[model samples]
Each structure stands twice: as structure tokens, then as C-alpha cells.
Target: MAKPKFLIKTWGCQMNVLDSDKLAGTLMDLGYEPTPSEDEAEVILLNTCSVREGPENKVFTELGRLRPLKKNKLKVLGVVGCVAQQEKAAIFSRAPYVDLVMGPRSIMHLPELLEQARHQKALEAEFRDDSVLYPGGKISRSHPVKAFVTVMEGCSKKCAYCIVPFTRGREIYRPLESILSETREAVDSGFTEIELLGQNVNCWKDGATKGFADLLEAVSGVEGVKRLRFTTSHPRHFPLEAALLMAERPNICHYLHLPLQSGSTKILKAMRRQYDKEWYLDLVRQIRSRVPDIALSTDVIVGFPGETEEDFLETLEVVREAEYDAIFSFRYSPRPGTPAAKAEPVAGEVARERHQRLLDAQLPIQTRRLKAFAGRTIEVLVEGRSKRGTEWMGRSGDNKVVNFTSTGQPSVNTYLQVTVERAGANSLFGKAVTAKNEAPGAKCKA
Candidate 1:
């Protein structure tokens, strides 16, 4: 028999990205090779997300497009991630050609499920509690130097506008020992940066003994790990202790991704965010007090239902005051079965206009703040060369993209001191200030 081939299309957060790596590894260990195109693959997987209506509709549309390829071939079509968990039987009913529907936690069983699918079977396997543990051996890492470690799974917060709690189920932290062992293994296997990921990273509770601070401290002590980072913290769960831990640990990057869905207290309460404007601003102040150099990134949703002109201005005020390093701004789109979906939407034109205004207001603030780094020499971890051969591109400790030209080839993942020459709307243009020298025990990549 010929070796099976697989293609996975990822469409969600970092957790889904990590899940894709694990799935690819599982298939590779099961004697499968990854293919660049879905047409030639024996398995076509959609690792999907349902946070937005646009992405959710695309999943079904892609499945329909794949219909011709599945006609006579033994191709297995699978849908996995938040959408699969949310849509469940509805996805199969909409596209019966789909062979398997598995959620994020069910990926470990993918090889076995693929065999079942190949034999003309259709199945849905989703964890009701979101605590399913998979064997750790089979991860085909997409990046050699940076790896994502899932400290916790799921979100218990039933934010009125979000379907995450329903789709991903409740929050549950993975064991601390498992996380540490995995971190050590990743370091051993040539990964220097390990990012702890969760839906609400700060809420991580491992039994009664450990939380996010404890976890960060434990991971920092690992011998080979050089840099640490995390993502998607809930304002309601953003503990002061975590901020203190970051301030104390030199290994932890001075950055945080805290989402502020709306600026108005009324709108925030409507979204069930559980924190008000005063509280959010106070947290920011507290974090800055401890780590003044911290670069903050956030997610903002504009034109949510019942959002008034005053509410929109409130958002602008917050954006101007916060001056985020970068912002992922969105125009609110209602997903079916979500609370916001039932409410009347603001007009399309109005929503578009508001989103543009938010972007316009935030840009100048970012440029002004980014100007501070100009003329300074800082360390950048080389990811690879940029499109223009004259320069190499990498990220700063605060996750800012820095571009510079080197005298010679620079190894990826090794930190290089670079002097900033220029700045773009979002990145820094620079040149190497010092010669490339390998740090001991550093995991340098291509």
C-alpha cells in the first residue's frame, strides 16, 4: 500500500496551531506524509474556529468545494477545533461528505478515526468536559526554536457574546509536572522559546498548589529555556501576582495580550466581561508600575449591538490612553446561538466606519510610542531573512518585528544586537551593531 498523505488547514488561535502540529505528528508516526495540496492528500482536515461568522461559513464552503475530490477517492474529510465542537452534527448534516468531526481534545485519536473514515464511516468525537489528555510523543513542531505549550484548556466564562464556553467547554489546567517535563523536553529538542497558551492564561489553576505565577517560575528555572511568553489573558482573571512574576523574571518577555472587547462599562457588562473601565485601567496602571517597559497588545470589538455614539467615543478614549503596541481590532459579527446574535445589529456602513475610525485613532499613538526604540541597540532573535536580501527579520523581546542587515548569514533563534536605523508603521528597520556570536546552550536554527 502507498503511504498516506495529509493536509491540514488551520483557522483559529495559537492553541489550534499547536493542535495542528500534534495532529500532523500523529499522522506522520502512523506512516503518513504531509502534502502541500489537499487535492493529492488521502486526508484533508479543517482545523477550524467559530469565533466569527465569516470563518464559520468558509468551513462549509470549503467542504463543498472539496466534494468533487472525494467522489471516488478514499479521501477522508475531517473538521476539528471550536467549530467542530460547536456545530457537531449540524456540520455533517450540512456536508455529509465530511468523514470525521473531531474537537480540539479529540485529535489524539485522529489516526484511528482516519482508518474508520477510510472504511466508509462517519463519526463525531468531542469531549464534553475539555479535559482529555493525549500522549505527548507525536508532535511534529512547525517551528524548531519556538514551541507553544498548552497550560490550560477551555474557558468557563460564559461571556454573553462568546460561544467559546459552549464550544470549548469549561477551563481545566494541565498538570504542572506534565508542563515542566514538556518544557524540559522541548528545550532538549532545540526549542529556546516556550509560550504558555490558554483561553484565559492568568486563570490557570493546577490543583490547589499552582497558578500562572507558580507555573512561570517553574518554567523559568528549566536549564535551556531562554525566553518565556503567554497569550490571551482575561481581564477578569489578570492577577497582580502574574504581573509581579513577569517583573521579577528576566526570562519572561515584557509583554501581555489582554483583550478589551469594548471600552464602555455598559457595553462591557452587556458582553459579560465582568470587569469595568475603571478596573481595566487600574490593572494597566498596576502592570506599568511594575514593568514600565512592557508592550501591551489587545483585542477590540467595535459597533457591538446597542453600542451608542458615546460608547464608540469611549472606545476611542481608551485606545488613545492605552496606546497599545499593536491592536487586533474587529467589527462585531454575530454568531448564531450567541447572545449578541439575537440583538439588532448596528448598520453595516456604521460598523465599517467605526472600525476604520478605531484604526485611524490608534495608528498615530503606536507610531509615537514606537519612535522611542529608534537609535537604540536591542537584541533580536533571528527568525529568517526578509524578502529583500539586504535585510534579516526577527522579533524583539516585546515581540516587535525588527528588520536589519547582517554582514554574514545569521542563525535563526540566536539573539543578535542590532542598532535601529528606521521605523515603519509596525516594524523597526535596523542594521547589526555587533558581530554574530553564539550564546552557550542556545538552540540556534536556520
Candidate 2:
């Protein structure tokens, strides 16, 4: 008999991606094979993200489309991750067909929960600091080259506009030994890049390792880890040592994703971001001075309660002054159960207008930033083939996507030198340079 098929639709950050991988690993161990087509699966799970309202809505929209698949068959449907934790028992009422609703922590119980879901709906949303054990096993991953290891989970910060603190709960650091063991095992298993993930990765601490910088140093020391990266850092928790480490460590990608919610101190204080515009600018200056070539990216929310025209203009000024290589900008949406939800929102048109202006302000910066790579030779880890057979897709150490046509097969995970021929706002077009002329970092990480 053929094995049952399973499909997972993951939405959100790298943390959710890592969760979906573990979920898939568990299912494959249970004798289910993965199918890319949702229609062909005996089971489907929507591993969701709830950090932003937009992603949360997309999850429901997708579920609505998938609900019809359950009309006449014994199909198992599930919801996992942040949205599952936030919605809890409420998701059952919203979508009665969902069999299992497991939070990120409930991943350890996945095999048992799927077994129990046959008789009745199962819900596991409770937060436990130690519930997520460091998973150690031989399992298939979506990506053969890169992997994400959760160094910690949850956020201790109480930023007023944020719901992560409520959904993921307090910060809980995974034991350092387990993390080192897992990373070493991944290197042994042929993985080269390891991304440490957490809500506020910089805030992680385990016994003597009181800061992310220390943790990063320890992991960077692990042999065979060609590239190391982490994400979603709040400016307040990012210490100077982390900046210094990025400068000194050649393997650590030269990229910083420090979120700057607003440029107006009033709006920032209202959002409880803890750092004012001047403080953020000073930090950026210090970092740039330390690591001049480091690529900078930020998160910006265009509209918030009581944000005046002046406040919006201040944001525009910051975008111009900061000169970010890229940005993830969004029109603010009030999330339920947050303090900002009760506050009067900016008019929709005004918010939309500001959002456009914010994008307009960043266009020149991004254009100029991307153009800087037009004449340079950069090392990229080949991710896979692009739409064109002759073109292969890859990312530079700074995480910029570069597409290049190569004469050779250029297998995934091999590092190749791509001397840029043209640049676009979001990605670069280039031709692969042969081994003789490869850049210093172009050694295939294996």
C-alpha cells in the first residue's frame, strides 16, 4: 500500500519555518510522505504567523479555500504556531473541520495529537518554558544547505503594540549544550548554515551566557558552520558587542535587521519601542562605523494611533537619513487584545498615503544601494535553479538575491562568485565567474 501523504503550508518568519520543518519531520517519522499538492494529501497543516494582522488574515483566507477539500473524505487538518496559540479554542468554532490545533511548543506532542484527533478535536496551546525539547534526529528538510535552530522562544518585552509577549510568553533559553550538539550534528549531516531563531534573539541567556553576543561567539566557534544568522532584533536588546562581533567574525553575515517602528519620538514612546529617534540614529551610526559595508534593513509601520502629519514626515526623514538597503513596510492594522486596538486609528486614506510616501522615500536609497553591487564580485550560495534553465538563484553573504546564468550545473549549496552585471530594487542579475576567478569567500562551504 502507498504511504499516506501530508502537506504543510507555512506562513511567517524563519521561526515558523523551523517549526514547520520539525512538524514535517514528526509526520514523516509516522510513515506519511509529503506531497506538494494540498489536494493530494491525507493531512494538511497551516503553520501560521500572528505577529502581524496581514499574515493572520491570509491564514484564514487559505483555510477557507482548503475547507472544501474536506467535503467528503477523512482528511486531517491542523493549525500550528503563533496563530494557533493566540486563537486557542476559538479556532475550532471558526473552522470546525480543523482536527488538531497545536502551538509551537506542542510540536513534541504532534504524533500523539494526530492520533487523538481521529475521535475528536485536539487543542494544545498552553505555554511551557521547557516544552520544546531540542529535537535531535535524522530528518528531511526543505532546504539542504541552510537550517534554523531555535536558541530560545518567547519574548519578555512588553512593547505596547506587540502581542508576541502575550502569545509566546516569557523568554526561555534552550540549554546551550543541546544547541551546540544540534548545530554540530547539523554540520555532520551536511548542512552548512545555521540560523539561531527567537522572538528577541538578542535577549537570550543560559547560565553564564547572559547575552546573544556570547552565544553567537560560542556557535561561530563550531567547525563547519559556514554562515551564521539570526533575526527580528529589537534595538534596545542589541548590545555593542553584537555589533563588534559582526565586524570581527567573517562567517557571520554582514547584515543587521534592527526594527525601527517610527522616527517620531512621540510615536515611538506611544508604541513603547524604548528607543527614541536620536538613540536609533546613534546606534546606526555606531554600527555603520564599525561595519561600514554591512547591509541594513528595517521594519516600519506607516500608521499608528495619534500619529500626525508631522510624525509621518519624521518617519520619511529617517528613511532618507538611514538609507536602508531594504525595508519591510506596512500600513498599521489594529490587532485585537492589544492596547492600541482601543485607541483611535488614523484615517485609512491618510495611512495609505503615508505608506506610499514611505515607500517613495526609500526607493532612491534602495536604488543607490543596489547599484553599489553592480560592478562588484560577491560570493553567493546557489539556492536552486531560477525559472530560466540557464539561470540559477542564490544569495550573497549579505542576503541579497542574485540570479546568474552559468555554463556549469551549479548545484545548490555550492558557493560561486557572481560579478554583478545589473541591479534592481530587490534583486541582482549577474553572470557566474569560474573557479579561477572566484572571490575569497567563494569556496563551496562543504
Candidate 3:
């Protein structure tokens, strides 16, 4: 028989993207080949997220649409990730056509679960063990130059509005040696950029020997790795030592994406963010003081329970002060079982109004930041060609998207020096200067 063909759809953050990769690897180990189109696949997996009701509804709707495919012939359908962790029974009850429903921590059991699904009428496998690590390489990355290495799983912080802690469980960081080994292996496989992924990456503390800083140090020492980056750091976990590490490592990108959910002390305290507006400002100041020219990004939630115009303005104030390179903005949505879910709801009209106000305040700030890069020569890791073909695209060390046209096709994964000529609200357009092999710039202060 032919190897089982599979198609996986992922929704959510980088952590979920890494999970989809691991699930693909698991399927590959079970003698499956990935199919580009879902209609042809024998096994269809929906890796989900529960951060918002919109994503949850999308997953449910997709599963309902896929029901006919399972009915006509032998096929397996699996739902994994945050939504599965949060609504296991409800998902099964509402969509009994689903053949398998597994949580984020239980996805490693997919091979075994698929076996059971073969004989059982319906398979509902939701195990609550978060410590298990799937052996590496069930599926290779689609990107030859970029690879995601998950250094930690789950979350310990039960933020009032987040279901991460309840869904993915407490933060359980991967062993430091395992992370280092995996990074080296990915480098050997021709990936030049390695992104360390975690819900709270900076909070990593696996054993007596390893913390997030130490993990970065180890990974930086690995050969063949050109760029190192991480994501979704809770402001509470920002340490002076970690800041120093970024400053000192040449390979580590000089971009920080610390989420500042709300700038008001009242909303922050209610959200259980642990850090105040002043504290976050101090952290930003420290990073800038240590490494000037370092780009910064953040996440902001505009309307929380009991949030007022003043509370929303405090957020705008922080944005103005920090002058972030980019921001991922959100309006609060009640999540079941989160502490904030029980609090009084913000009116939809009011929330939408606040969201638009915050966004309007950000666009010009982002535009100004990009304009500053104009006329500067910076090194970019080219990913691929843009849709128009007149431009090749890549990201700068600070994670700004840069695109430029070249006379010849420049190979992807290689760094190119581009002189920025024009700037847009989101991306930079430029002309390729030269392809040089020297180290781009000195290590920033740690």
C-alpha cells in the first residue's frame, strides 16, 4: 500500500507552528507523506488555538466541512493544540464526526491513536501529560533556510485573560542539552536561522544548569547557525542578564518582542501580568541603554474587563514612549476558565472603538520607524521572491521586512547587503548592493 498521505492546517502562534511540524514528523515516521492539498489526504489534522473565539469557531466549521470526506471512505481526522486542550468533550459532543481529538501535550501519541482509530467507532484520546517530548525529526521543515526549535512547552502564568496555563499546562522547559543538540542538527540540515519558540521563553528554567540565557549561550556556540531569535517573552521574565546575553551575542538578533498586555497598573494587576507600566518602561530603557539601535516589538490588548479611556491611553502612552518597530494589537475576548472571563464584560462597541484608536495611534509610529531605515545599508537574510517578482524579500536583524530587486536571482538563505531606498508602512524597498561574506556587524552590548 502507498504511504498514508496527510494534510495539516495550523492556526495560532509560533509554538503551534512548531507543533504542526512535529505532528508532520510523527505522521512521516508512521510512513506518511505530506500532501499539499487537503482533499487528497487520507489523514487530515487541524492544529488549533483557543486564544480567541474566532479561531475556535473556524476550526469547528472546517471539521464540519470535512465530515463528508470521512463518511464516504476510510479517513482519519485529528484535532490537536490549545482548543483540544480546552474543549475536548465539548468538541467531541458538538462534532462527533471527528475521529480523534487530542490535546497539545498528547500529540506525540498520534501514531498510537491512529492505530486505535482504525478499529474503534470513534476515538477520543486526551491525555494530560505535558512532560513527554517527541523524538526529533518526524517531518522536515518546508523552508530550507529557516527552522523553528521549541525550547519550552506550556505556560505557568495563569494570566487573567489567557487560557495557556490551563490549556497547555505549566511551563516545562526542554532540557538544555536537548535544545542544543536539536539546534546543531537543524544547522546540519541546511537551516541557517533557528527561532527558539516558547509561550514564555524568558521564563525557561529546566534544571539547576539551564535557564533561557544559558540556552541562548549554548545555541549561539553551535557552528553553521547564522541567526538566532526567540519570541513571546512575558515582561515579568525580562532579566538584566538575558538582556546582556542579547547584547553580547553577534548571532542573536537585536530584536525583542516582550508583550505588554496593558499599560495601566490597574489592568495589569487585574491581568496578573506582575509587571507595571513603569517597570516595562524601565526594562525597555535598560535594553536601549545597553544596545542602542536595537529594534523592539510588542503585543497589546486594548480593552480588558473594567478598562477605561484612561487605561487605554496609558497603553498609547507606552507605545509613544517605546516607539515599537511593530505591534500585534488585540481586543479582549472572554476565554472560558480564565480568571478575567468571570469579570464584567467590556461592551463590544466600546472595545472596537478602543482598538481602532490604539491602531490609528500606532500606524504613523511604525511608518516613522521604517522611514528611519531609509538610505541605510543593512544585511538581510533573503527568504524568497515577492509576488510581483520585481523584488526579493527578507528580514533585517531587527526583524523588519525588507525587499529589493536584483539583476540575477540571489539564492535564498544567504545574506545580502541592501541599501534602503524607500519605506512603506510595513516593508522596505531597496536595491541589492553586493554579496559579501564578512560578518555584518559587531555584537551589540549584552
The numbered model that scores best in lDDT is 1
What's model 2's lDDT at 178?
Answer: 82
The lDDT per prediction is: 0.83, 0.82, 0.82
Per-residue C-alpha lDDT of model 3 across residues 11-47, encoded as one tens digit per residue: 9877787788888887887788889866679889899
Give lDDT tens digits, candidate 1, residues 170-244. 887888888888888788877778898878888887888778788888988888788899887988888888888
TM-score of each candidate structure, all chains considered together: 0.95, 0.93, 0.95
lDDT of 2 at 320: 84
Question: How does candidate 3 score on lDDT?
Answer: 0.82
Prediction 1 TM-score vs. true: 0.95
Candidate 3 local Cα displacement, residue 390, angstroms = 3.4
RMSD, every candidate, angstroms: 1.8, 2.7, 3.7
Model 1: residues >4 Å from true position, as ranges?
72-74, 128-132, 387-390, 440-446
- Candidate 1 has its poorest 10 consecutive residues by lDDT at 128-137
In terms of lDDT, the poorest run of 10 residues in model 3 is 437-446
Clashing pairs in 2: none
